[model samples]
Target: MRFVIKVGTSLIAPGGRIDTVLMRALVDQLDLERHEYLIVSSGAIASGMSKLAFSAKPKSVRLMQACAAVGQSLLMYTYEQLFFGKKVVAQLLLSSDDFTSALRYENLQHALHELLKLGVVPIVNENDSVSVRELVGAFGDNDELSALLATAVKADWLVLLTNVDGFYDSAGRGQKLVRTVRRLTPKMEALCGEKSELGTGGMRSKLRAAMMASENGVQVAIANGTAPQAIRNAIERKIGTYFPATKPAPKKRAKAAD
Candidate 1:
């Protein structure tokens, strides 16, 4: 089954700059990978901030979009350089409209299918420069955007890489992490903390994304992006948090019509 791995801004940026080592590690793992993968990446705004020498996330929508416009190119450049040895990387900017509209949705699926077939990994993100509502709303984070993309592609699994190891009972107080979650509840949402200054989404957004993916029959996992082999570990179910698919769907045929 194909996997949609969402790399959060927090993991991409360390100490207000892009962590090239981490980027290389991730792409290195992708180098010898067996499964077809799509990367839903978030860091344009953060990259913009770094370029403009801004100390904090901009409050104005226009400024935010402007940063996205400038940073989007740099973000892709970084990926291009890091992924030079591996499969080609294609930049895919998406908006809510793209998924909400039927014609566009089908087009997106077709495009992604072709890209993957040709050994190209689609680097997806919300069209921040174009979607104003998405820039200001809670859903601005590409966490939920990634989940939506997973549903659009009928992905078998969705992996959300965040700052923390996983969801905890408290905000780094009671426990270090919540190992596995079969289902998400209101209580889980309540435990989510505020958004980081470097990134838009918090644990709340991740939990919401997991719920959305689960409802669409996709198994979701949230884990620490800082871990060296985090993505590989998650894929092997060796560590981090796991959210199993709870939503029921039509079962597949046992065999091709015999």
Candidate 2:
């Protein structure tokens, strides 16, 4: 089955830098998966900030963009090394316009299909290095980018790997974890928490991304990226906050004769 795997900054760029140990482990997990997979990764800015010797995410747009510029190359280098000998990895840095523009969108779709057809793994990320909107968080960033890709590709599943294991029942005692969410509702949406210290997205953004993909007929699962078995568990439907694919809403019936 086709899969879109999104790993956030929390797991990838912990403590404001690329966590090599965690990344290697995640890569090992990916190596075990025998199915087709596409990655939507976030952490270029967070990882870049450190290379520049900045202690934290910079406040200025120019600084963030600069960080992204530096980070994108470094990020791709790391991925290339990890994915070496396993498969050929291609980097595709995109902006919001890539998905919004009709001609660009078609080209992207064809390119992605060709890559998958050729057994090449495309590592996708926002072109934060030069993206004004992405640098300022003024549009749908990686979370939504993943969703858009899932919809466009008609993927069977979209797996979101976060720092946390999965969504929890906020009002439940001890905040009970909710597994296998069959429907996305208003109450469920309210359970989302705030964004992480180093990333633009949070449980809220993930839920929205899930909703967007689910509405387009793709199932979703939210799991912990750091777990050794996250990739396998999610595909087996044995763990994570699973959102099953639902039937599309029926079209309105024609009006009866007056």
The Cα local distance difference test for each model comes to 0.81, 0.82
TM-score of 2: 0.90
lDDT of 1 by residue, 63-164 (tens): 899888988998899989987877689999988888889999989877887777777888998889878977987465998898988887777789999878
TM match of model 1 to true structure: 0.91
* Per-candidate clashes, comma-separated: 0, 0
- Model 2 clash count equals 0
The alpha-carbon deviation from the true structure for residue 58 of candidate 2, after best TM-score superposition, in angstroms, is: 0.8
After best superposition, candidate 2 residue 22: deviation in angstroms? 1.4
> Which candidate has the highest TM-score of all?
1
Candidate 2, after superposition: displacement of residue 132 in Å? 1.7
Where does candidate 2 stray beyond 4 Å? 31-33, 171-173, 248-258
Per-residue lDDT for 39-66 in model 2, tens only? 8888999889889999988888899989
